[model samples]
Target: MITSELLEKYTAVKKTFSKNETIFEEGNLPLYYYQIISGEIKMSNYNDDGREFIQGIFYKDQSFGEPPLFLNQKYPANAIAVEDSEIYMLPKANFMKLLEENPSISVKIIENLAQRLYYKSVMAAEMSTQEPEHRVLKLIDYGITHFDFKKDQNGYLINFTRQQIGDLTGLRVETVIRTIKALEKKGKLKIINRKVYR
Candidate 1:
C-alpha cells in the first residue's frame, strides 16, 4: 500500500467507519482505491439464505477492493468494516495517475494483487477437495505467511473467529468448532482460555 504522506499528496481522503458498516455493496461500480489505516475490513458475498462467504480479511496497512477499480468493473463482493476503522480513499483517476508516476508503487500493487489471486486459487482448491483439517491448516499457514498474526507464549495467535473461519473456508460454524477441537487433540493447535494458537 502507498504511504500515508504519499497518498495524501495524491489527494487521498481519510474516512472513518463504524464496526460492521458497509463501505460498498456488491455490484457497485468501483471508484476509489481503499487502504486501511486501522482495524479490519472484510470482502464478502451473501447467498440467498444470507450466509456470508468471506472472500478475504484485510488489516491495517492493507489495501482492499482494488481489482474492480483496476478492471473498471463493478465489485463482485461487499466491503465491510470489521471494526471501527480509518481508511484512506484515493479517487480512481488519482490512483491511476499515482501508479503511472511511480513505477515501483505500480509493481507493488501488481504483486499484492497477484498474491490475493494466488490465495483465492489455493483456497478454492482446498474447499473443493481437502479434508476439513487440511483446509483449516492451510488457511492458518497462509495467514502466517501473508497476514499479520500476533505471537504469544504458545505460538502465533490465530485472530480469526470461528464464524469468520467458517465463512472464509465455506464450512459451517459447527464444523469449524469441531475441527479446531480435533486439531487440538492431534497437537496441531492449542486452545488456551478460549483463544487459539498455532
Candidate 2:
C-alpha cells in the first residue's frame, strides 16, 4: 500500500478527467509513476480495428504505470481516469532514484508487481473456465484482497461502466449486462441505476 510520507516526497498535481479523459495512451514513452489521490483510472487498449477495450481499473491510493518504469519502457496499454481526479506524480528520475536509495522501497515495488501478476494469472485462468458473472465476482474478490475493500463500508466503489468491466474480464458487454442482471435477480448484487454493489 502507498503511504502519506511517500506522497509528501512527490509533487501533487491537480488534474481532472472530464468524464472520459486519456491520462496516458498506449505505446507512449513511459514517463512518471502516477498515484491516484482520488477518482479511478481505467487502463485499457484498442484492437487493430480501433475497437476500444478496457484492461483494468484502478482506484484511489493505488499506483499505475510503475511496473514498466524499470528502465523507461513504453506503456502496454492506455490509462484514462473514470472521472475528475487528482494525481501525485513522481518523475522517472526521482522515482528510480528514490527506489535505488531505499532497499525497502524496492522490495515493496517488487512485491506489488508480483502480487499484481499473481492476480492477473488468476483472472486469466478464470476467464478460460468461469462464466461472466463468476468472472466479475472474482474481480471483486481480487480487488477486495488487493485493495482492502471490506475495510470501508462503501466497498470498492468501482466507477467503471459495464462495457469497461466486460473488457477487463474478456467478456462481451451483453454478457456483462446479462450476468449483472442475473446477479441482481438473485439478490447477490445490487444494481442501482448505473452503480453496482455486492
Candidate 3:
C-alpha cells in the first residue's frame, strides 16, 4: 500500500465512512484508489434471494478495489464500511502517477494483488471440492498469513464472525456454526467465550 505521506503528497483525501456506508456501488466506475486508515471494509455481492457473498474483507493499511481501477473497468462488487472508518482516497489519475514515480510502492501493490488472487483461487477450489472443515481451516490459515491475525497463548484469534465466514465460504450461517462446533470436538478449533481461536 502507498504510505500515508506519499498518498497525501499525491492529493489523497482521508475521508470517514460510517458503518454500512457504501464507498462505491457495484458497476460504478473506478474513480479512486482506496486504502484504509482504520476499521474494516467488505466487497460483496448479493444474490436474487438476498444472500450475500463477500468477495473479500480489508483492514487498516490495505488497499481494496484496485484491479478494476487498473483496468479502467467498473467495480464488480460493492465496497462497504464494516465500521466507522477513515480511508485515503486518491483520484485514479494521481494514483497512477504516484505509482509511476515510486517503483517500490508499485512492486508492493503487485505483490498485494497477487496474494489476493491466490486466496481467491484457493477458496474457489475449496468451495467447489472441499468439506466445510477444510474450507474454514484454509481461511483461518490464510488469515494468519495474509490478513495478519494475531497469535496469543491460546492460538490465533479468528477475527471473522460466523456470518462473515459463511459468506466467504459459500456456506449457510447454520452450517458454519455447526462446522465450528464439529471442529472444536475434533480438536481443529476452539471457541473461547464465544470468540473463535484457531
Candidate 4:
C-alpha cells in the first residue's frame, strides 16, 4: 500500500460515498487510482441472470481496480461501496507520474499486484475442484492471512457476512449457512452470537 504521505504529495483527492453506491461500473475506462480511507468496498460483476459474483472486498488503506490502470484497459468489474465510505482518488496521469518518480512505491505496487494474482490463481483452482466446505475453508484462511486478522482466545474472527462469503466462494447463501454449520459441528470453526470465528 502507498503511504498517506506519498498520496498527499501526489495530491490525491478524498471522496465519500454512501452504502450501495457505485464507485465505478464494469467496462468503464480506468481513469483513477482509488484507495479506501474508511468503510468497505466490493468489486463484483453480475451474470446474465443477474447473479452477482464478487471479485474482491477491500477495506481501509487498501487499493482496488489498479490492474486496468496499469494495463490501459477497461475495468473488469464494478466497484460499489458496502457502507458509508471515504476514498482517495488520484488521476491516472498523476498516479503514473508518482510511480515513475518513486521507485520504492512502484516496487510495493508490483508486490501488491503479485499477491492479488496469486490469490486469483489459488481461488480458481479451489472453485474448479474443491468441495464446498473445502472452498469455504480456503477462503477463510486466505482472508485471515491477507486481511491480517487478529486472533483472540477463541480464534480469528472473520469480518465478512454469510452473504458475502457465499458470493466470494461461488455458493448460495443457504449453502454457505449449511456448510458453516457443518464446519462448526466438526470443530473447524465457532459460531458465536451468529458471527463466524475460525
The candidate 1 region of ten consecutive residues with least summed lDDT is: 144-153
- Tell me the deviation in Å of residue 75 in model 3: 0.5
Error of 3 at 46 (Å): 0.7
User: Candidate 4: what lDDT?
Assistant: 0.94
What is the Å distance of residue 168 in model 1 from its true position?
Answer: 0.7
- TM-score result, candidate 3: 0.98
Candidate 3 weakest lDDT stretch, 10 residues? 141-150
Q: Candidate 4: lDDT of 181?
A: 98
Give me the displacement of residue 116 in model 1, in angstroms: 0.4
Worst 10 residues of 4 by lDDT: 145-154
Q: Which stretches of candidate 4 lie over 4 Å from their true place?
A: none
Q: If both were scored by lDDT, which would come out higher, candidate 1 or candidate 4?
A: 1
| Clashes by residue pair, model 1 | none
Global lDDT of each candidate? 0.95, 0.76, 0.95, 0.94
Kindly list the per-residue Cα lDDT of model 4 for residues 85-155, writing each as its tens digit. 99999999999999999999889899988999999999989988999999999999999999877799889
Q: What are the runs in model 2 whose C-alpha is more than 4 Å off?
A: 7-17, 147-159, 192-194
Tens digit per residue, CA lDDT, model 1, 1-198: 789999999999999999999999999999999999999999999999999999999999999999889888999999999999999999999999999999999999999999999999999999999999999999998998888798878999998999999998999999999999999999999999999999
TM-score of each: 0.98, 0.83, 0.98, 0.97
